[model samples]
Target: MLDTSTDIRLVKKAIRGSVDAYGELIEIHKNYLYRMAYLHSGTEDAALEIVQETILKGFHSIKTLRNPELFRSWITRILIHISIDFHRKSVPSIQIDENLPETRSLGISIEERLDLYEAIRQLPEKYRLVIVLKYFDDLKQDEIAGIMNIPRGTVAAYLTRARKELRRSLKEGYLNG
Candidate 1:
């Protein structure tokens, strides 16, 4: 979670031409940004590129930010847009590396996790984005709507549809397995 007052101060300094302030602000949110990017892009390399692009774009346009308190959402909006665009222009692929260390701590078996990931990957782009932002990123529906530039109702609808689809897909996987 961001400290709003500190973010406001850093945002002000960054807007006023303080490179260190901008870097520090970005550093605070780098892991979060990468997670969002990785969830959206489905690849470490693409996620890294998306995060770098988001940081650069944020740096260039920090002065244009109207509310410093909303800096995290603002940068996140940029990352989401870049990720959506990147996905649109590229062929979609899913690569689940079973040996990844993060898989061990989730309590769920790796096979189950991989099945869930595959199910998520099979969802439509809008549904997938909603799932990633809402569940994976732990964003509220209103925040997701804001970041995704969609209505709150639409976000809710997407979540409903996405969850339904995930259930169907995962159940089918279980049956087949």
Candidate 2:
């Protein structure tokens, strides 16, 4: 005789033996995760795979999570790792043309955002991870540190360096023009 009200609490606790609860988590976060994966991968098929893989792994490891409130950040970190791993194995040399247009434009012209994304794309893994986690995800430095299991000072340094590098890239663009 399980009621709907009790069902929710039960579901949250059912990370041990219930696929339904996992499905609920997926239903809630799948679209957002797919968007994040698409931003990182630039392909729908690859992004879908990343989302699916992330959900699968996260579901299997839910017991390791101590706080339910950390679920989003936890899942996001998993997605980031999975996306980077896929890129490393699949893309050799990670190339990008400085002149290529940004893809996020709709009405306001996403040129700056695209430029930023391109600059980020050129960064080495460590710096790039920090930038994406901080800027793109709009995460606080402390939250980024928590999810990354890193020092907050390291997060700040990465963001600072990433900003400098992006500025250099933009300046190069102007000089070329």
Candidate 3:
């Protein structure tokens, strides 16, 4: 995460066609962007492609950004667009090696993590985007609304519905599988 002042400086420099500043901004946000893309696509290759496309699109349009303060959100919006486009064209298929040892984190087993990820992937696109943007990307409702081009209230509503559906799906999965 970048401080407000540094972000402003970087945005200004990037807007001036400073590739180094653009590179710095990308370096700061790339990991989080990759994680979000990976969660959405469920494959490292697709995630990398999404990130790459996002960089290309963002770089080309950086000069058009009116507000430097919104740089992160703006770039994130680009990434979301690319992610949705990629998802529409590709069926996410990541094969897990059953023989490999699964690591545990925060009391959740790898299988449990995979289950949650699969469940999210199965959600309707609107609900899935809202859930992923809100939780995975740590974006606020207003930010998600801006990125999705929806009303803030709509974002809130989608999040509420998504959480309910996720709970139901997890419960069913636990009972059956």
What is each predicted model's overall lDDT from 0 to 1? Answer: 0.81, 0.70, 0.79
TM-score-wise, the better of 1 and 3 is 1
Tens digit per residue, CA lDDT, model 2, 1-89? 12355444544674576788768767867777876786676567777889989988898888887656667787888998999889887
Off by over 4 Å in 3: 92-107, 172-177
Q: What is the per-residue lDDT of model 3 for residues 24-92, given as tens digits with 9 covering 90 to 100?
A: 999988887787777778777778899999999999999999888888878888888898899888856
Clashes of each: 0, 0, 0
Best by TM-score: 1
Worst 10-residue lDDT window for candidate 1 reads 98-107
Q: Clashing pairs in model 3?
A: none
Tens-digit per-residue lDDT, 64-166, candidate 1: 9887788888999889889878888878775755543232143566788778777887899889988878777778999889888899999999988888888
All predictions: root-mean-square deviation over Cα?
A: 3.5, 6.1, 4.1
Q: What is the lDDT of residue 113 in candidate 3?
A: 64
Candidate 3 residue 175 C-alpha distance from true site, Å: 16
The worst-scoring run of ten residues by lDDT in candidate 2 lies at 100-109
* Candidate 2: residue pairs that collide: none
